[model samples]
Target: MLLLQQSSWALYEPVPESYYVHQKNINSVTFEENTTTYLSGQWQYYPKQLLQTATPTRPSRTVLLPISFKEMGYPQNTYGTFIGHFKIPKEFIGRRIAIWIPNQYGAYRMYLNGDFLLRLGKVGKTIQTQQTENAPRFAYFIAESEYFTVTMQVSSFQSLHGGLENPMRIGVSQTVNRQFQQLMMSIAGVCGAVIGVGVFTILFAIFRGVRHSQSQGFFVFGIFIIFLALHNLFSAPYVYTVFTNIDWLWGTRLEYIFTYLSAFFFINYMFLLNQRYLHPAVFTIAVFVLSFNIVITFLSVPEVFEKLVFYSFLLGIIVVLNFAYGFYQTVNRHEPYSTINLWAVVLLCVTFLHDFLLSLNWIDSVNLSFASTSFYAFLIMVQQSKNYAYHSSRIEKLNNNLLCTRQIS
Candidate 1:
């Protein structure tokens, strides 16, 4: 069983051995254990400015998981730490023990048995100096004693979300590593697919010279996908491999900036797709939104501008809804293929809104926006090809008619 106790900063003592062992069949052993059980209970939380003090005082109160710094009453840009101690079971001794963390919001240090085992990015006092390492990491230490302690000092000066948002687990090294590898592979494959499609569509438009509004629309959509993919990649922990030593402030700024760019191009793409509506104001709105995002990116660091991103996204929703409404009205006007565009735009807007809410901590839902967006993009690509063919056929017929008329004359 887990224990929750409040104390000023001090070393955690081993728990009494009389407690029952929660074990099951793991790794051919008669009893297996879930690593999460070890981390489930309350932890001692220290808010703001972790110092190198020899003995930090215990926390004043408790904070729960699935909570953010904003909700915790911490200012926009702040840092915090969480400390937890768990008993090493007699059975775990002599085994290569490892701990797996699902998600950590920012830079952090993981300590085992009072020894620093792993550091993700550089934890610092401010965003300017803080280097964020956002990656899944695990360290192996032979269980030498009957108890062990895990302390995490996590710092966040950029994101709206902060702290330990997911449960961690301790288990055999091989099992944990395998799980982490699988998760990384899945993310990599998805990112690869988006990049591939984005590149192909953009190249096709460029080489074809974008003769009509339909082709231009496709090109804009491609740009949106490319930037969206970049945003996802930069937001991942693995990005540290490529951009090692990146300042946390700049990294987050770029991530959200890419997001804004994607939104901008998406609106432009929608307008170009259905030209019969011919609304000039939509283009003006897209330009205004894009300019706003670009100005803010240069004006402030992430901690200050992060809130603006959310609000700007909220404002962008108005543009998205307007586009969808236009498409719906076009369908009423008996415009060809307008129904398909209407549904696609509606679905895309919903996905975008859901993800925005998820980022803001207003709601929790599995983010399937990327997958849905990809599906709709593919459909649009196919339809754009058809539109091009249709226009070509009409032009060819018109030329033939003109030639016959001149011959008769």
Candidate 2:
């Protein structure tokens, strides 16, 4: 009962209802303590124009919020402006309201009620004049009027067409901040759990001894878990919120590096496990392949991340191939824990494919590296249990033989 009482906050968290604009404005919205809203729908879009504090003129067209860079024929490598019209209950006049622009690609200047509130990245008319930033932005202001206008000037010169790719959030200050807090907390919680799995895996490997057949691979697998967690941390919104001034380039580099290491360590573990079936020549081939990708990453610019996206797909293929062979070996040898390996490989491959398509921008879903690792860890633990049983029986037999020989002597 006490546990349930403590968890009641989870149930009481502000629930957000999504709302879209119609006829260029959203009206009759009410702000409450326990609710927030997504500012979506159609907004006035002015192409190739960067407006200042003045009201936007007749829009050249309209684009929906949460639209992709290519959606609705939205052009790439262009500057633009968006105007959002919203009306709230009069009770909000004396209270504070906040707008949250979730982290995503692009850079912009934000204005509310004809006042400049945020300038995240340089918004310019040309590529030479723009600097792209992908991070969350927020502003709070006392509502002086029932109707408010939000104007944004955005530039998409150097990235996957930044613009307004994500929906902005609006609510009373507390509710909006609470939403951001929850997002960060969820991400941190997942990362922390993955790290715990990693530490336990390492400890288990040590307990089994360095001479154990699975120890090397199991230890490396633990390292992979740690790398995976770090990669997720850097890639998530949590890092952006903590390191507000972090360059997009440096953050991405760390993310990419960790991603590469995680894949490498996991693949290495696979090689170690299948040494009987895999030749040393294959290890050389794998190293050469990964080394090439690493070299290119270090030599290239930030744009390398997008251009080298093929690397992500290639990594996915390698990961799936390694797991497939393990599954085959397990089934062929009739390992007692083969069932666990089968399901682990299948689920890992599925998650890898999900992330694979997500990398290519073909799908939208949660990154499942942590889930995949957890599944693999479970399989590893089960296999270790089998090894312990086998080794214990052998030791017991040795003890019996020694005792009988001593008695005879």
Candidate 3:
């Protein structure tokens, strides 16, 4: 109890929590210096309305920001306007302020204090006119006064759910810039590491291969990891898409392709490892389904392909179960390092489940993408190491036999 109390006391934040907008009250909120704040909480929601002007209007309802429109009783292809207010501190008036707008479901235009600001894609009233583009962006404005109003005109015609799926960050230039840079750096570092491991794994597999050995497992694993890494690097609503000159539609397509194909390779890897346990028919079916999904993803638009993700996730669950059962059988047979392999499978499965649920919006939170990637990379390393040891032992035994024959001669 004493230790718990001490730890709780140690969790004190550096700044006060007085900056939050409560019950539509922005006057009492004071902007903190160098502190990043998410522009969440209640915002005016006007459904089926798209305004081109920054002029404020009466809202039909108030809904929380960063909420899925489907959960809020809105159907697909909903268009709306959202209004948020935050007051700048007296000292910060006339100074430069920055807002970090993360990716949302559709196209949007941001306005601050009745002035045109950031426009991401083209917001329109109909499917033909509406151009959807999802990406992380930033907007800067000089605080003309203490009271600042943010107006957003948004539309989602090609997505499953509309409205702001991600919370926007608001802060001073220095703090926001630092946070953005750190985010990008961290993403780059992680993807770079995954890519390196994949390359090394492929090379290692080639080095260990001979006329009699099955080294294609490692090769397949390495290829999948590379694709997965690419998926992570060029994830939608991220900076890499901007660098790659991809809009949300193409970026999302790449995500689905990389993700599905990586699973495809992984399934083949499993079949190679436990051919008897995983039936050939089942493996073939899985491959066919994944391939079909990839084709449909490329041909169909966002609305059409997004619905197919649920079925893909269902297939993924079946695949994970197969892996679990195979590992369990291995452990029961008392094979060497079987226990470790089983536990690794369990860890990998858990991460897969977490991300899978998040994708379905059943988790109501962000996906543990990087964590899942790390766990996968760890699993790859473990299996590769095991393969390496087995080959080394085999080589040693062959060398010993040759020496014995020479001595006898």
What does the lDDT come to for candidate 1? 0.64
Off by over 4 Å in 1: 1-39, 48-59, 76-80, 87-92, 121-133, 145-147, 166-169, 236-247, 275-279, 338-340, 382-409
Query: Per-candidate TM vs. native?
Result: 0.74, 0.78, 0.84
Which has the greatest lDDT?
3
Q: Which window of 10 residues has the lowest lDDT sum in candidate 2? A: 1-10
Q: Name the lDDT of candidate 3.
A: 0.71
| lDDT sort, best first | 3, 2, 1
Which residue pairs collide, candidate 2?
106-162
Residue 27 in model 1: shift from native, Å? 21
Q: What's model 3's lDDT at 58?
A: 46
Which is the winner by TM-score between candidate 1 and candidate 3?
3
Runs of candidate 2 with Cα error greater than 4 angstroms are 1-24, 27-31, 53-59, 89-91, 203-211, 243-245, 275-286, 311-315, 318-322, 325-335, 364-409
Q: Superposing every Cα of model 1 onto the true structure, what RMSD results?
A: 7.7
Query: Which regions in candidate 3 have their CA more than 4 angstroms from the true location?
Result: 1-24, 27-32, 52-59, 210-214, 337-340, 382-409
